[model samples]
Target chain A: MTQQISTMTATETVIQAENVNIYYGSNLAVRNVFLDIPPRQITAFIGPSGCGKSTILRCFNRLNDLIEGFRLQGRITYHNHNLYAKDIDPVSVRRHIGMVFQKPNPFPKTIYDNVAYGPRVNNYEGNLDELVESSLRRAALWDEVKDKLGENGFSLSGGQQQRLSIARTIAVDPEVLLMDEPCSALDPIATLKIEELMKDLKEKYTIIIVTHNMQQAARVSDMTAFFNAEATAEQGGKVGYLVEFDETTKIFTQPSQEATQDYVSGRFG
Target chain B: MIPAAQPQKSVDLGDLKIDHSSRRSLFTIAMTILASACMLLTLIPLIAVLTYVFLQGFRRFNLPLLTQLPPPPGLTEGGIANAILGTLIVVGIAAIISVPFGVLAAVFLAEFGKGNPLARWVRFATNVLSGVPSIVAGVFAYGLLVKTGLTGYSAIAGGVALSVLMLPTIIRTTDEALQIVPKEVRMASVGLGASNYQTILKIVLPAAVPSIITGVTLAIARAAGETAPLIFTALNSSFWPGGVLEPISSLSVLVYNFATVPYEPQKQLAWAGALILVLMVLMTSIAARLATRQKTY
Candidate 1:
């Protein structure tokens, strides 16, 4: 573990999960998993449907707590603090670890208000105009929308709405950003734009994105974690497990594991 | 390259073409005729009611009839001003009592309820209350308010009964409206670090405003036309009500009284009052529609 930590000295680890397992009622959705997400770098989780990539991403911000009967057995530490500690507030965790969903979910409000909502709710007592402007700029949407901040968010095109959702997330100045298939609903051009924005955003915030698109994982991520499902003896059903985690270049080029090679090379999911 | 496969002769059969086009036209024509017949059926009753009301009530449509109070048994020199005023006051008070509680209840059911047993029971009770007869609500209010001498035979008692009648409507409407607010919006607010109360107030309530207003307006309109409850609670006072605790006569009660009278003039006044009541309801409904015209998204 010391050697592994020292090998990535330039980028520090921000989130560390040890033998994390998640269950919804009696059914286990995610098997024991271990992962370390580095600071100021993008980490992409790639897998087929129901491979627990999104579930793991949701666990980081405790979004899965919204589900009934959801329980977890694990130690997930953020900045050396246990995220699921009894005294820690999920609301505050979510505020610092913002999320962008697969679908573009801008609030039913004006573009300006949508961007300003986070700051206002969290009581960020700074210059709001500056905050909204900077956040929108970081999201790569300020130029196109600068003149029409008062217009309704739904008036924007799909790409713009997704960007607006990103802007809304960043407006709170979160330390870590989690995107659950943020560009799945976007066209190729929009996807490219968001990809570029993600590259830029990683300089300031750690990003963990769950994407089914393997090419996107290879192109944008510094490290890639490939996940797959394996049959469980007790449940007689497939449960998601992390198959491999390595540098993105190595994962795509010369993966150590046969499953990672097959997944990246498109032989199988 | 292989020669292109010859077209299948059977696939382009003329009989199939004719059958398809003929069936398509038949279906189209059938749908058109059905829609037209439905529209005509809906319009006929509306036109007939309007024509009948206008013809019967036009003779008594004068400024004096609107401004003056209803005449006594032998006299023929008055309007329904007091009754109209009383109706407005009673409905306004009922609306004041019902809207906040109903909206709050709906918010709880939609946002925090999550199928909890208490929320489910509250919802079930609201549904049952909605099905309860308005007169029964009047009886309930009379038992609670009049029997206890809280505000015996007063506008306050009438408003309380009407508010009960309106509560179910407002709750159901607000519930449906809040339910219609996309779940993503609430999640987004919660994601933004806003508390549950703040999310309901800033996000859920605003998104549901139009539907809530429509429901509240419909409740008010329905409450304005209620006479049985008003009769039991507000009783019929010839003089104008001085306060919420004083008994008042509403338009419906005045119409009921005048229509049952032996005089010809009173009967005409009843028709006039009916026309006015219909007009007021129509105006309110139209205003509500206009107010909610803004696009929700």
Candidate 2:
């Protein structure tokens, strides 16, 4: 019930969730929650396994609609539009808000085709070569894959495939980028490269990332939200609840809540 | 008391044991040999038939036998050229009619259908259709086409019959091929903002091309040797077909007719026709295998 609006006037809020609760059939996964994500800033959602951080992230674009028996009692707004509105289309919502999965899931296609897929589907009729090049450049992958555009996407190294997937997503020119553990399957060097890319991408797009690594959250995020699970008496089940949301520096250095402090200091998940 | 102080003398030991498992392994070897012999016995008839056909037909493998039309019963100077052409035309027509429909049906079942009840029913019906005998399909086509006076006993009718026989096989095989395409590729396409249709067209189909080709080739091979369907629909004509509406003679029907004749030359011609059919089927199967060469990097 805390309606703590931000005092900062210049930052534009791009996404907001109000009293959100997600369920799979009768199983309640995420409890009541409210969150505000600002444009051109990296917001990281970190929590222990099964705390529903990724589930909440998927709710932003309604990706959870693909699952059977998945339902939500909440309002998630992207800019001025309610994403779950009856008149809205999930495909259009996805085109505007792209997602990068945990694993590098590049299509079994040529590198060029993989990048071109998104643009073509979105009916982008501009200069394709330039679009692909710019998207790959923005993803920091153009230099590595420029010579091998004809090669299969699966032929790339795991790290490179992840970057190619990012390039594919950016080719559609989505306004918001949601990454779910984008670097968990990568090595340290690949992780560093992605972190750097995230920093550059935030200048143009709003980003919300769910990561397990606390250090990654501290290093890349501008705003951090800590989520924890609490047992619900009515349902006889554990439901994830937001513990704290603040400036990343304050959350890591001087948290307002004891739970956030415990989570950040590695005392408890 | 050191009563009967234990004897300190070393006792003699028996010789070391030798493993007898290897000796007992001979029984397994004997059983395996017997099983292999039984398998070989089962294959004897197939080998003997092939060998007999080859021995009798090799002498007829001349240019004239392939290029000339069937001669009068007393003459031995004709070939199976018209029959081959007729077979090619009918099979080509059948393929044209069936391949696209079959592949599309497969795409519906494998990609768009997912868990749709209608797709499941269609799939089940297709399995049932595949199990139906080729002669039954021929009879159905005869009843539908001949009874309607739509060029009774014509090449088109034959093509329709063959297509019906080929449809279920093509659909089932293509569905299996599309199913084998890794879900990761589909997910990647969807994640990139591609619509379901786009994902299927770009990602799912391409990855399954090899298997699809394999399936189509096998179907074609099966269609080439089908005689019952052609007998009922195309009937048998001594002359070449002028158009789709005219009856035509295929190699299978030609072989069947020639094999039943009471002449030495005709029997020889039948053997030659059989040899050509086997060769064509073999080449097709080989081509299919070649097309599916796995590419890994």
- iRMS of each prediction in angstroms? 1.2, 1.9
| Number of backbone-clashing residue pairs for each candidate, in the order shown | 2, 1
Angstrom error of the Cα, residue A238, model 1: value is: 3.8
| Whole-model Cα lDDT of every candidate shown, in order | 0.87, 0.86
| Superposed Cα deviation of residue A61, candidate 1 (Å) | 1.0
Candidate 1 C-alpha lDDT tens digits along B64-102: 777888788777868777888888998998999999999
Looking at model 1, give its docking quality level: medium
List TM-scores for all candidates, in order.
0.91, 0.88
| Residues A122-146 of candidate 2: C-alpha lDDT, one tens digit per residue | 8889999999999999999999999
The per-residue C-alpha lDDT of model 2 at residue A140 equals 97
| CA displacement after TM-score superposition, residue B59 of candidate 1 (Å) | 3.0
The segments of candidate 1 whose C-alpha lies over 4 angstroms from its true place after superposition are A1-11, A231-237, B1-46, B291-297
Write down the C-alpha DockQ for each prediction.
Answer: 0.60, 0.51
Worst 10 residues of 2 chain A by lDDT: A1-10
